[model samples]
Target chain A: MDEFSFIDSIKQKYYKQPTLLKGVGDDAAVFRQQNKDIVTSVDTMVENVHFAKYTMSPFHAGYRALAANISDLAAMGAVPAFYLVSIVIPADLSNEDAGSIFSGMESLASLYRMDLIGGDTVSGKELSISITVIGYTEPGRARYRSSARQGDLVFVTGSLGDSQAGFHILANKGEYEEESYFIERHRMPSPRVDFAAKLSGIKRVSLNDISDGLANEVNEIADASQVTIILNEKDLPVSPQYPQFPVDLQHKWKLYGGEDFELVGTVAEDDWESVKEAASNTDTVVTPIGYVAERSLSSKVYLITDNGKIPLYSEGYTHLK
Target chain B: MDEFSFIDSIKQKYYKQPTLLKGVGDDAAVFRQQNKDIVTSVDTMVENVHFAKYTMSPFHAGYRALAANISDLAAMGAVPAFYLVSIVIPADLSNEDAGSIFSGMESLASLYRMDLIGGDTVSGKELSISITVIGYTEPGRARYRSSARQGDLVFVTGSLGDSQAGFHILANKGEYEEESYFIERHRMPSPRVDFAAKLSGIKRVSLNDISDGLANEVNEIADASQVTIILNEKDLPVSPQYPQFPVDLQHKWKLYGGEDFELVGTVAEDDWESVKEAASNTDTVVTPIGYVAERSLSSKVYLITDNGKIPLYSEGYTHLK
Candidate 1:
């Protein structure tokens, strides 16, 4: 269980790249990406901070860290190229166990053509993983968060909060194999790269990955654009099992529970049909969740309910808090 | 003590850049580097791992995390451009203390021209800081560790083991105010950016930042290049305080103790004098430490001492052993 062996196992299990000039054994991972703008971002997952170690699988832990960072690149309409992972694992953990974590990360990186460039592995009291993803966007075509306007229609790429439901089911150890869909959603949420890449200029208003629940992320776009967000409760996409919950629970899960890796974005009114058509070709549905309004520079976000427009508190999983 | 407050404090204290498209608050920091070869590296500092939390000041902790990453860029002959810091702090710490950590990082970034880009802050059981630095090198001039040849003379910038001595003094609370030079060397080692920039076209044998002790790093370069390195112990540079150490302790600390952020490199034997002269103008002295030797392909590093040639073992710090 030495550092070199742990790193070797990771390299054998995960690092498969033709572009890497040098991989895990070197001081740095060297890569070359041509004809596109390189987009880079980093995300750190810590034990008892981002996740509880005993409650989550090491594979899922590894996958989630990479997925979260890839999602940031996806939000920018970039193709993930490579990643550097700095891991601080507990000293007691054997190299075999560490290899499991790295195996999971390497698998994801291989799947996405992400060359494992360089990372530092150190001993710590708990597990902490910091992954920095480097991606590329076509010249002058990267979508940004400042592009949303007053009249754009908001849309979400996939169903929300299934990951949260998965968390609850796994935590309770509820005996329901029928809940596999939600369980997998929570454990291994996909970063919407393919869906986002094709979503170039038309629906390329303000965009963010739905991580801190739709309610909070939607508000983030609204707050950033300095506009009012009107969320249509009926249009909010939910998993098939969502209705099985009581009304209050469903609302609570949909609004506050986090870890949904869907894409929440906005599109212009006239371009909505084409955006939907393009998304349809990818076998993914884009549901209209809301519309933008003139600046609602207030502390409140709201849901348009049948009863009336009611205040929707923007409270999701606050990692910092 | 809230997350927003913590972020606000960092924004006010550290994130000041006129060209920063988005700084601390956004999902990612955006900026444009001149279309030069973009050089990037990442380094992490962990509590009770990289530094003992009880012993290391939060400000030095913060400064060192950034400095280590910046040093990587310096080794690559790149200019400091931008950095993203991901900090995982224990919830028990206050917001103002968090501000001070960032304030320390800001002072270094401002001095080095590294803009504080976007970062993620989270509550964890222990403190951890990961910094990713992005810099630019003129096209095709970025130095690497694989470029050394058989006839190259190994060179080191500045004296080694000063940081280790500083560590000893600091640990014992030794009165070393008269030895301020060594203390500063340990507290803050300068990255040789200006000197490295001028060393272009000199065809360096290999280049690396010396943090994990000279012997260990020289072994790394030799291991990577499949060459034997021969070092003369008598020729090694020692700071003025070297005589204060008992002989064995001096050699042990100089050879194995880590955290000296200097450059260990190799150059053509013919270019040795010019390289030394160039380093002199930068107010840093470069000394020849060793020579690349032709050895059995399987031979490890060797050192020539008064006793005889002995295998050089890497007894430095390992992250997850």
Candidate 2:
């Protein structure tokens, strides 16, 4: 198809927001904001590393790309406003597939009242997508990893290993895609933008979405805050059936298999009650599994097992094991 | 190299600005802005279609990618403040080469006083770079293509066809890369941000950067404003030596060849004197080559040549005998 028709197919299903002065067909998109600092995040998902046709459909890949950036906005306690979808696809990609990709993204954009502002589409050696999400948060209200303090309680929303567990199911073909509980979790991580929006009312919180596994994300907070985090293995919110796998493999996926979009964060011990109340109002299940303390000389993160306490490796948290 | 060290290498060479609340090593880059509307543009440059290693180095590719987005900001009359660099590369790219790419982008970012805020680095089949530029324009004062009026004078900055002329030299044999003017023209079309900055002080202007071609850009302005544009063939600022090529090919490059980052815009006929004064004060050359008129039954864009008056075709504009 021609470029104009291709662009029309994508723009035909857009959700135009009132805040947008202009969307596509302009030199640059224009938007107005007040009383909020803009929160921006960009991420790229490539064909084999992030997704494959065998693992997920083109529509899911498109949704996942936008979801990844939205996950970051959730971590920042920002409300979705607009996004730019920049995609590079193989020359031979069918027009139908291209339209599907945009349709999938439009479905999610519609959900959050976000406008698809401006970006470029170009042909590349393989399918690769980069989405830049533009959001805004109240001044002095957005969460940050560096704000966690001593005596804070570390809480994580939802399950930790659903995405990775779903990934394993898709990678291996024992179960059908639709029948398995893991496929949707792996393919469509409904980013917690609403849950994050609720947290802006509460104060003294620091959070991050678990995209690079719970262990890596927890360590990032610990390192940024210069505090020590002790996570109780028994308290980790895992899928009910995941622990049935070989303990080592189960622990591997739960701690380090990445791609989960759950928000893990810390709240001051005194404000925990209010944070929980806000989460309850949003119907978001936030589970506290650890506590922050002063950092010692050795490690910033520790994982307690049935045997004893062991230091967690900062890099991937797996090298020690 | 590991992702950590690769990110660290790039982050180490950055020039931080006070407006940036946070940079690399966060969930998302944070910033503060007031009074101005946020201006955003995202563009992707693929490996072979946009650049080949034979014609441009990886460093040049990285620079050109950011330059493409910066050109959009220029057209919007926005002062570029931050940009997200999302890059996908083959797994085999060496650390030194990767560092070179970031250095090239950093050079441009430093010159513009723009912060390299947030993005992702992923593995892909071939090199692809997507840059999202975040800028701010004076509230209600940005130049738009829809604002051109009948009887307005259309102007272009510097010269056209240099980039395409430069492209032919790099694509074919004979001339080496260094000694010629066209190579740099092709490799680095310095975006007209300064010129646009000057125009921001002027009122009621419409502008766009020539990415696809001058004819395509002028047609966009005419179509958007619902007016007619007429070009004087003698007034077009072609490179002095470029017109020496065969007349047909010369016209082809001048009128149709893409990738020229020059600014094309229309201003009220009365503002011409003040606009030229602003351009000269900034050491920028503003050349008036056409005028906007009420649309008639003929083409929205026309070129007056030796043969006769002819409508400019929106697609490539190459239909003269």
Candidate 3:
């Protein structure tokens, strides 16, 4: 099988969108951008840097690429529309492995109902996959982390630190039976599209998807909006999957771990009840871990721990550069 | 400067489009796609394989990435609007080298008035760049290469053989003075977007950008349209810059060289005069090179050289895997 066959496999599995005038098999894709505001993000995942073939299947790695991109769109409350993928298939890649990757990407695309419009596949020494996800948001209603205001209540969707715990389990080659959830959390975390869509209806929502850990995302929102975030460490949400790890490691992963695909944001205190009403009837669990405070020139992020208060830094998941 | 600095530098040089609801510095860029069909394409360039830092600066390499994507849009007669770039920068790359690449991209961006909407920067062993260009075409009017009719006249914009010759000159490290034109053709080939826009007004137009050598592109159109294409060697437009190479090398490069960024297309015999008039005022030089013939199951492409008619195969620049 060659590159064209690889494309054929993708085409066979893609969900055709009404707006797609032309999909794969052209020099470029043709699509109609239904008169709406478009949300776009690009992310690249290198073989070893993002995932290892030994730790997870190629299927999981490919799935992670789209998951990460869709997370960005979800943060803005955009509906996934179309995506273009470019893959540098490594020379040593087995056909079975490559097929697994495409199949994995197909699974995510079908789940999200987004069309795989255009992509390029080329041979290279190291495998890298870059995806450009296109989605649409309601014009002025798209949420941004930079809009958080003082006295707003800080909140997050779903459990935190699950991805890091999953990494720990896999790194130690834990028993297969007990590790599936953790592994899925780390390798196949889905974007909070439904949850974000639910909350996006409210106007005071300021959101950022947590890819680089909760602390880092908090710092980003605080710095962007020129506010201080005070998080109660005891209030941090951790998955039931973390019982196997020691308390210290669990806290470490919970506070500084990344790739969780959870979302962190701020909403006005008066609108919290409305957001809770919107969040109801969804799979996601909402938690208020902190509150937005007036800007402090000394420190932007702080955690209220059992031992006392501590400043939080953006030290989560720095890639090997 | 670090990767963030690189981003800041790009932010400083980018143009904000009126359709862009939000530009860079967000999780995902937001834009309003006017009610038109969008043409999208992605390309990745790897270091050493696509360009050498010795012969060309990092700026030119970065510039070439966007130029290549714009060329694909030009072929479809789409107006270049927005683009996103993802770079896997190698660690050994100096800050200056990285700066040069961004500046190079900025120059092209300013020239085209296309917004640099979003991008990502990460560390990898080899420097690789991927660009996705988004443009718009009047619905149902975007030119596709799969519409050439039998008996249609084939035409190409600008000269060929120059990029390959420029490659040869650089490969051999010949003096820099006399080879500047050829080298520039190789390193900084501009997309013929304006030229394509002029001819796209004609209905008989079936266009393909000449990234893969002209012969290969001809084969694509013929195969897609179920027709045969025969090239007249005497009519082949070799750039005057090719006198440096011997006759045989010149012919080989002209017939099989790639990265030309020229437009190869066909027009009905009745529409040739109108097309010529449309092309005259443009800076591009349009030349008639061949004509489409009724499909034959046996052969798809043939070259009418002085020696004899020969079957043409795709022998364009093959990247090293």
Candidate 4:
């Protein structure tokens, strides 16, 4: 199908939201959000750079791209409402694969009842998907990276390093018994929207989605909040199958390998119980792996390991160096 | 500089808006829009496909990309407010060139007092920009392509095909005395946002931006509105230097050449005067190009020329065929 027909098909397939006045077949999509602050994030994933066509299916790529953007909204303590996807299609891509990409995104968006408002489709040399998601939060209630306080507990949702391990298995075509579990983690990451939405009731929490691994993300919180973060290495959450990997690779993946799509944040000592209650309500696992400390000279993140207290540098997936 | 440093530089350079609760350095940008309906459009310009580095400067490409998206909002009769830019940078691109792309977008954005809210920057094999612009209009007041009525007069803002002619001059390295004017039109096409913002006062209108040439835009309006559009070829506005070009080339450019970034729509004959007044108020040029007729069998667009009336086909740019 041509671009217009494909768009028409998408318009026909996706259900509309009550607030969406206009969806497809318009110069712009129009939506109303009453008395709520809008949270928006844009993310682009390119072929080869983000995913290989052989290793990552179009469906997974689409799911992961949209999931990553939604994770951003979740980090801001917002509920995703709408999204626009701009996709650059390579000539070699099949129509089924192209449709699968949208199917993947729709599968995730459906869980949140998010509408696909509008986007652009173009033919290019490589397949790339740039998604812009719009979500809503109460006025002045959205969480921020700069809100972390000294003595606050730094916590994480779900297991860290599972996605990276999954990716490693997929890339190497590993035939381990746990290969399916790892691969699924890599292919279908669950954005912590439910857990984050519950955090809106807790005041003054700092949050950041772990797109760039734990070391990089906590360091960002520390840098933004002008505080020092101390993480207990043993407390880092890992899956049951994580021990199957080499010890060194496990350490590396847990620390540096990115694309976890889990929330890492800090909450007050008094509010820790509330956070745990929120996690329980959402049926999500929450782990306190670290604690915020007063900055000595400058903001820094440190890992408390058996070796020693070593500064955690942002060695994860630095783009455009 | 690395991606983080580059983003830091951008965050430092761009000014913030009062409505913007949060800008860069977060997972998502948060902004408040009180009671206004949000109008959003996303457009992606791929290098070597939409533009060539040799023919289009980075600054112009950036400016044009944002301008195109803003034009969509304008077509919906919304006031341009904020934008997010996602840029894919090739390894070969210089930092200065990379910065120029944003500079281009900022130049036009400053005119509308639009804020550079948030976006993504990634390294890729080709330089591409995907921009999502968010604008606001009064609730249920945004214009649509399907709003045209029978006996309405079709109107367009500014001259048509100038950008195409300018692009031709630039691509062919033609150094005519008017080359600079045409080149400027091609590189920095004005998005008629001022005139469109004034259009909100009009009661009912069908609007479409002439990005994919007038023929395609009018046909879109016709198809959406279920009306037949009859255009008078003689009434189609042209630049002062337009006649100097070959007649056939001018006709081809005016009809099929895209990237004009002008507004085209149909308004009631009674409302035509109000549109003209709105144009005059904004100091914009407006022309009566055609009239909307009742759809007999199916929606159609026709042109009245010296020879006879001819059916207009959507021969504009069609991506991902």
Candidate 5:
């Protein structure tokens, strides 16, 4: 197809707005922001690394790519503004597959009012999609990974290990043919943008999403804030069938399995009750998992089990591994 | 490497900045724009299609990926602000190779004062790099492809066809070993950012980067503007060794070959002289190639030859093709 024709079709499908002064077919898209600071994040998903190549659907791949990046913004407590997408597909893939991916992404983007501004499309040896999401927040309202104080209580939105369970079901054969919850959780994740936005002035300390598992993310916050994180293993919000997996193995997996795109954050102990009430009103779950303490990087993450306190292992998905 | 550690190293190397209110290890990087509108563009380079699978050096791949996207901002006449990069590499490639790519991109980015913000990395079947660059421009200073008018004079900065020639020689056996002019052009063609910035207030008719060659870009301007584009074949610029190709295809290739990241723009003929002079003073060559005119739906591009005007053919790289 001619470049102009391709771009024109995309613009018609995606760039509909009074805010978009320019969109596809231009060298760059221009946007007017009411706020001064702009938040941006870029996330790339590959065929085998981020997802299993053969088992994944194109639509799910598209949704997951945007969802993962949008979750990052939620971690920052920033509102989604615009996004740029880059897709590299194998030459063997059908045009229908490519279109479905865009359709899925466009569906989410339109729902969020995230403008699909500009990006590159090319042929590659594997299917890969990278999205750069640009967002905004009140200049000082944005949260970071360095603000948690010694007495802050740590919290996480929604249940953990659902994504891991979802992945297990989706990656395996017959056991979950009718498991829509598992498939949907694996495919589409809510970024918790509204919840994060509500927590704006309530003092969110050391915020981030659970992409690299809950324990790994806690370790990240601990390392960044130079503080120790003490967790109550019994308090972990697990699903009803959590005991089906081996006891020790499941706990380890729950804390280390990546792709749990929930927001893990912290707040002052005093504000915890009010924050929980506000979150409940918004229909967003906020569970207190742990507390932040003085910096002790040597063994920062600890899990309180019935046996005794144990160091949380850092066995999360490593890129090289 | 663990995701956090990889991201931490990337942040230390590229995202060290005071203006960056927040950066990588966080959910998103927040930047203070000082009340400037953000101009954004994204470009991706895939292994086999964009660059030869094993021919282009990793450093060159990195350089080209960043340079190509940077050229888009230059086409829009916007100044560099910040960038986020997403890379997908094969599992077999060592971290050193990835480091080399980032180092090379960093070299170019430093010259432009582009803060490397945040990104995601994953292992793919082949190498791919996607960069999203955001620039700061005056509210309405951006030039677009739909604003060209009848009687508007077409202008291009720097010479064309050199990159095409460079690709031709580099693809042939034993030709890439020497330091040829075409090879240099292919490896590194400077984006005309300074010249583009100067043309911000001159009432630009239309603007676009000449990637996929000048013919494709001029057609884009014409189609977007709903006008005919007439080009003088003799007036086309040529490199010093013009007749070395197999046939007298210098002008033909310049009109149709891809990978020339020069800016092709249109402005009122009245201001063309002054614009040309100003561009020349900066050692930036600004040459007139054609004029805009009314066109029928079917035939919009006409090549002005000694024999008379004839229908122009589409010859650049088509993504769908």
Candidate 6:
């Protein structure tokens, strides 16, 4: 099928949003959202830089690309509403592979009731997918990384380091009974939109998604909020099978390895109970790993361990200089 | 400069939207657009497919990418507001080149008061840019391709094939007195957002942007509106230097050459004067080219010439099978 036919098939099969004034097959998509603030984010994943053809299936690539963007929306305390995808297909890729990519995105989108409003498909030297997601939050209530305050409890949702472990296993072709769990975590991370929505009741919260590793994310919150953060290393949450990996690898992955798609944020000490209640309501695990304090000179992040306090530098996967 | 520093520089320089609650340096950007319909469009340009290093400058590539997306919003009769850019940077690209790309977009963005809200930067095999633009229109006032009426007058804004001729000149490295005009046109085709905003006064207008050539765009409108459209060949608009090229090349480019970034639409005969006045107010040139008719069987588009009536096929640059 040609480009038009493929788009038509997608529209017929998946473009069903009654609230959208127009969706697909137009110069632009139109919709109306009254009385809510709009949150928008875009993420792009390249072939080898993000995922390899041998290591990742097309469906997972698609799912991961959308998941990364959706995680951003969740970090901002917003509800996923609509998304537009732009894919660059290499010559070697099959039509079925392309379709699988969309199917992968659709699988995640359906769970959030997000509409596939618009997108562009083109030929390129290698496969690349860029997704722009639009979400909604209450007026003046969207969370930011610059809102952390002294005495606030720094928390993280779900287990950390699982995705990195999963990726390591896939890259090395490791054989283990727990491989599927790691692979699934890496491939299909659940965006914490539900848990984030529950935290909206908090008067003020600071959030940053753990996409570029805990070190990088926490540093960002500290820098943005102009506060120092101290995390208890022993309090870091890990999956059940995390202990199977070497101790050094576990430490590295949990602290510096990224792509966990978990939420790392700070809430007031008084609101900690509300946060815990919200997490319990959503069946999400919440762990208080750190606390925010006044910055003496500049913002800094540190980890407290049995040895001593060590500086937590931003050592995540930075793309370019 | 590292990734964070580069983003920090961008945030300091270009992200200055007073209305945005949040901008760069966050997981997502937040803004509230009360009591308005949202319009969004995305466009992607690959290294070799859409442009080349030898033929286009970094600034022009960046400018053109955003221009294409803005044109889409214009066709929907919306006012351009905010945009997110996702760029895949090859290793060979210099920091200056990347900065130039954003500078190019900022130049156009400043003209329309558009905010550089959010985006992603990634390392890839080849240079690619994907831009998503968000605009706003009065509730229920956005135009659609499916709204053309049988008695509507088909019209086009400005010249059609200048961009194609300009691209030909650039690719061939030809030297001529009019070379700069064509080159400039090819590099920075103006999107008709102002004209589109003016056209909003007219009710029930059907519109499409000429990014896929006149024939393909008109065919799309015909197909979407389920009406027959007949274009008068003698009435097709061309630039002053258009006649310098061979007649066949002019004919082919005018019909099949895309990327003019002009608006093509149909307005009711009663609203024709209103359209003309709107164009005049915006200092835009408007020309009547054809008329919409009842579809006998399937919707079709045809060109009326001295030779006879010829069917217009959707022969634009379609990617993939």
Residue B52 CA displacement from its true place in model 1, Å: 2.7
lDDT of 3 by residue, A1-321 (tens): 876677777675445677777777667888886757778889999977887777778999888888999999999888898888988887799888887887788789788788888888877668899999988777677888788888998998888888877777778764644587888888899898888887766887889998888888899888788888899988888776566688898877887788898889899999998778767856778999999888765439989988898888877466422
Question: What is the DockQ for all candidates, taken in turn?
Answer: 0.44, 0.84, 0.71, 0.85, 0.75, 0.91
Task: Report the lDDT tens digits of candidate 3 across residue range B1-321.
Answer: 766777887675445567777788778988786767888988888887777776678989988888999998998888898889998888799878887887788788777789888898877778888999988887776887788888899999888888888878877865544588888888888898887777756775888988878888888888778788988989988766566588898887777778888989998999898778877867678899999888665438888989999888765457422
Off by over 4 Å in 2: A12-16, A175-179, A296-299, A315-321, B12-16, B175-179, B296-299, B316-321
Pairs that collide in candidate 6 are A1-B321
Q: Name the runs in model 5 displaced over 4 angstroms.
A: A1-10, A14-18, A53-55, A173-178, A297-299, A318-321, B1-19, B53-55, B173-179, B295-299, B318-321
Decoy 6 TM-score against native: 0.97
What digit string (tens of lDDT, one per residue) describes model 5 on residues B47-115? 667776445677777877788888999888888878888888677777777887887787788888778
lDDT (10s digit) by residue, model 5, range A109-177: 777788888877776678888998988787788888777778899988887877777766766666543
Model 3 misses residue A73 by how many Å?
1.2
User: What DockQ number belongs to candidate 1?
Assistant: 0.44
Candidate 1 error regions (>4 Å): A12-21, A53-55, A173-177, A201-204, A296-300, A316-321, B12-22, B31-35, B175-177, B318-321
1 or 5, which is superior by lDDT? 5
* CA shift of A154, model 6, Å: 1.0
Candidate 5 has what TM-score?
0.93
Residue pairs clashing in model 4 are: none
Q: lDDT tens string, model 6, B94-132? A: 889989988889888888989888888888888999999
- The list of candidate 4 runs beyond 4 A from truth reads A12-14, A173-177, A295-297, A318-321, B12-16, B173-177, B295-297, B318-321
lDDT of 6 at A249: 91
Compared with the true structure, all predictions reach lDDT values of: 0.74, 0.81, 0.82, 0.88, 0.77, 0.89
lDDT tens digits, residue span B77-161, model 1: 7777788878888877777667767876877888867777667787677888888887766666667776667878988888888
* lDDT of residue A76 for candidate 3: 88
RMSD (Cα, Å) of model 5: 2.9
Instruction: Please tell me which predicted candidate would have the highest lDDT against the true structure.
Output: 6
Count of backbone collisions within predicted model 5: 0
Candidate 1 TM-score to native: 0.93
What is residue A185's positional error in candidate 2, in angstroms?
A: 0.8
lDDT digits (tens) for residues A23-62 of candidate 6: 8889999998888899999999898888887767999989
lDDT of 2 by residue, A1-321 (tens): 766667766773455566677788889998878778878989988887778788778898888878888999999998888989888868778888977887778778788888888877777778888899988888978789988888899999988787877877776667443336777888888898888888777777899998888888988898788889988888898877776556777787778867779999998888888778877888888898989878644338988879888887654532111
